[model samples]
Target: MDPVDYVFTVRTGDRKNAGTDANVKVILHGDGGRKTDKMKLRNILKNDFERSQIDNFTVKKQFKIRNIEKLELWRDNFGLGSAWYLDYVKVRRKDKDTEYSFPVFRWIPAKTHLIFRVNDTSLPQQDPEAEQRWNELKRKRDSYIVCQKITGGPAQVIKLYCSTSLKGQVPKRK
Candidate 1:
């Protein structure tokens, strides 16, 4: 078997697909998250190296993004406790332009995963997306792709999971 190497992936709460809508948002560090942010990343990278997966690993990483918005906290109290939303937008438009006023729900500061890929050299950048690396990372962040822990022997097979939701469905609605 080839020596294993780790690929870091920053996963979001929303599941991923080629057409999945990754509720992307700018993540402002929370009270505790800010403190351990560096530690968590450090451990994640170190664990791989300790395991001897590859000769050398990387530190900086990011994923593709379809969209993103700065988050503003929204407070709602229902019975037991209050809830905060970081992914929502208030919009105003001219009636002549068919203005619709509503709070658009969004996802921001998403759950991230350190996805690993094994390779002998750095990953190649496709010609088409070379110019839009930041956007691509946003897309990748929106879609949290978690690697399942393989408890058994070698993974003999691989599977692809896609969603059936009509709203985020890809292919561009006409």
Candidate 2:
């Protein structure tokens, strides 16, 4: 197979201490269980993974990856202040004009591995990954609890848990 070029655009969250100096790696998973070896993301010309920054990186793959399904991203946690807040990651195949976006709006602590599925909405019952779907639903239910704000009124929702790094940083409602 001819070598293919994949462009990865990583967007860092625009929050205090959201950047990290640790080395980051990614693995692309495609249909039929095809996957690429872990590839390091780096750009020597300028500092990467800074807060509110978009960094582009290219990786050459010897095999073709069709229909990217999931992305595995992690950091080596090798540098000071290694915790990172990632907004999202977009991947594009230059030759095929194919693109996939993974929405990962969360903080990734040191030595954490995050697997993001392609940005596709599906019912939990129809989701292919049973474990992932269950866990996600459970987490959301635990974090966003339902309560009755008034008697004989519609139930109100509230988020009971917030990350320590995001406390007092969330934008106020307009």
Candidate 3:
């Protein structure tokens, strides 16, 4: 299962004492269309409830999910008396052209998963050397194919195969 990581930034209202005290939960839908529950991602406003000055508060959080095909985010207000604002979610995949941004004028749905399409231009690009290597591998399309989440870091190590027919075989990393 491939693991995907995401970072979300959010803020609440300007009211000093009115914000969420509940935890935000993220649901991951993986291959075969299965949903897996992840740990609650705590909100900054909730953590610092006492020191909050309430001037357009904002907070950032990072979470990871393995075998993620799609994901849904939810937060239960439980009559917390205030609505939370989701600014945006940043995904590591380069195949997405834009980050997920929430609308400022409307209230977001209580239950929904944000969906995004992977575009060609959004795929991540490594350094010059890595780019050159990738191009070389791509040229031999019949012989090699690169898979996602090969490895994490500035220089990503994509899983590849010597040939398309060679399943269950991991080509040596150059």
lDDT of 3 by residue, 60-167 (tens): 232333344444556665445434544333333222333444322122333433332222123336332355335544644544434433444243344244244446
TM-score of predicted model 2? Answer: 0.70
Tens-digit lDDT track for model 1 on 61-165? Answer: 222111212112222222221122221222111112221112322232234322111111233463322433455466655554333234443422222243333
In angstroms, how far off is 133's CA in candidate 3?
44
Please tell me which model should have the higher TM-score, number 2 or number 3: 2
Point out where model 3 deviates above 4 Å: 1-19, 43-69, 91-106, 109-174
Q: If both were scored by TM-score, which would come out higher, candidate 1 or candidate 3?
A: 3
All candidates in order of lDDT, best leading: 2, 3, 1
For candidate 2, lDDT tens digit of each residue in 1-174? 566788999999999999999999988899999888888899987889999999999987645687899998889777787879999999988897778999888777556566788995567687666686566567666676555544566765567654343355442221
Which parts of model 2 have CA positions greater than 4 angstroms off?
120-174
Worst 10 residues of 2 by lDDT: 165-174
Which stretches of model 1 miss by more than 4 angstroms? 1-90, 94-97, 100-106, 110-174
lDDT of each: 0.25, 0.80, 0.41
TM-score per prediction, in order, is 0.17, 0.70, 0.34
Candidate 1: count of backbone clashes, pairs at least 3 residues apart or interchain = 25
